[model samples]
Target: MRRGTGRRAMAYAAVVVGLALSGCSSGGGESADESAAPTVTQTVTETASPTETSTSPTTQTPSGSITPTAGAPAVDGPVVAQDQLSSPSGNIWCSLEYGIECEVKESSYQPLPKPADCRLDWADNQFRVDRSTGARGICRGDVTFTEQPPELTYGTTSVVGDRACQSTETAMTCWDTGSGHGFRVSRDDYQLF
Candidate 1:
């Protein structure tokens, strides 16, 4: 009987010591429950009133940036077409321009080595082949081409008139009816038709 009682006492003492050690083992003296407490986060946003007219310059955001220029005139005419041009050295040039803006790109490319010109006559709503040489092509009006970013997955096909565009997570392709004059926008490089 004495030996059994001594063993029982020793077991009880061992349990008590184990409990005490566990209580102190928590780091920074924080309880286990306190350490596992959930954290809360708050986000705040500000909006301007309709009556407010901000004179401050435009600011850029993390996703994208657009700065308003003082002397830049507002773009006129609807966007009719888009084109992506690629070079033999694997350089990509993409442009999404309105009918009037296409003329600007065409005249601007006159001095450049690459054929970056996309001339459009907004008055006639026609795509011009070569403004300097007076070549004419198709006519498109108010047809918008939304560019698909490389990160987006390409699913299904979006066709417009004689054009078809397909997008993948890493690549996008827009082509004419015959796949003759088109381009592919990819994460690695742009392929022109």
Candidate 2:
């Protein structure tokens, strides 16, 4: 009986030692759950976002940098004759008068009316005097094109009455008689294109 009590005491001591060793882990440190305990937790929330957009207004002009519109005409004549261009065929007259140089271009190359200096023929949208001593055609002076960069000036005279737009760099003084004849005069550097 005494021997049996001795063996039981030894077994109890071994169990205590085993429990102590288990408390101290293999790395010889306390468990992670005990060391890391949450102290404070913060949550972030976002509100409505602002809208970003451009506030500039749009105002569009013609192609050229500076385009000056012709003021309201004092006389009563259509600047652009839509009615005249309705048919594929119509008569349009352009007369240019520069000092000591004057000419007229018509759709048809008819004989010059009495008192007129000469009669010209229209060829390839251009009318040229068959025989003339001076430099007088329909096109004369400086010209600027809205679609092009470099401006041009013409010394020769040739008729360009059928073009959609007639432009000249030179200044022109124009007056419409309401009749078939429209008067255009250029002085010195003045030109009709």
Candidate 3:
């Protein structure tokens, strides 16, 4: 019976590791690496089960301590919504509404801490919240800005190490294929294409 329990625990661990990997980035070929970067549609599913107390006499010794087998929560972490991402730049922006907070350099924007009103809209062009290169970070998904220009569409994914440009249309969204670093859609014209 103990052996069976251990096998079940191992199976659960494997599933979790698999899920985490599927969301990670790849280097040369297709592989998973979580530290890489996260995309928009990345969904995390958690199932909550009611705590069950075993009535087995032998399992419950006189020590009065209930021993958990495995596959349990080791630490407590806050449950962040999919729209809200905690980037290395120290700013949290709503991927749905307000534009991403990033650094603007040489027509490129990298994630960085900034005020809520990062995008200064104009009739023709949209200025982004300026960030210092010293505080560089990754951009995740490539989303479209239906408002164009002054609206500065967000959601473009550059390669893990390479700096790519965000397109004004669908060119800005990143695929879940696992490109480790997240990126920002910059208004700059410098293209690496």
Give per-model CA RMSD.
21.8, 27.1, 27.5
Off by over 4 Å in 2: 1-51, 54-59, 63-65, 68-123, 126-193
Candidate 3 TM-score to native: 0.15
Best candidate, lDDT: 1
lDDT of 1 by residue, 14-45 (tens): 55564455557776554465432221101101
Q: Per-residue lDDT for 66 in model 2?
A: 19
* Ten-residue stretch with the least lDDT total in model 1: 40-49
- lDDT score, candidate 1, position 49: 13
Ranking by TM-score: 1, 2, 3
lDDT of 3: 0.29
Cα misplacement distance, residue 174 of candidate 3 (Å): 5.4
Model 3 poorest 10 in a row by lDDT = 66-75
Tell me the spans in candidate 3 whose CA falls farther than 4 Å from its real position. Answer: 1-81, 92-94, 97-120, 123-193
In order, candidate lDDTs are 0.32, 0.27, 0.29
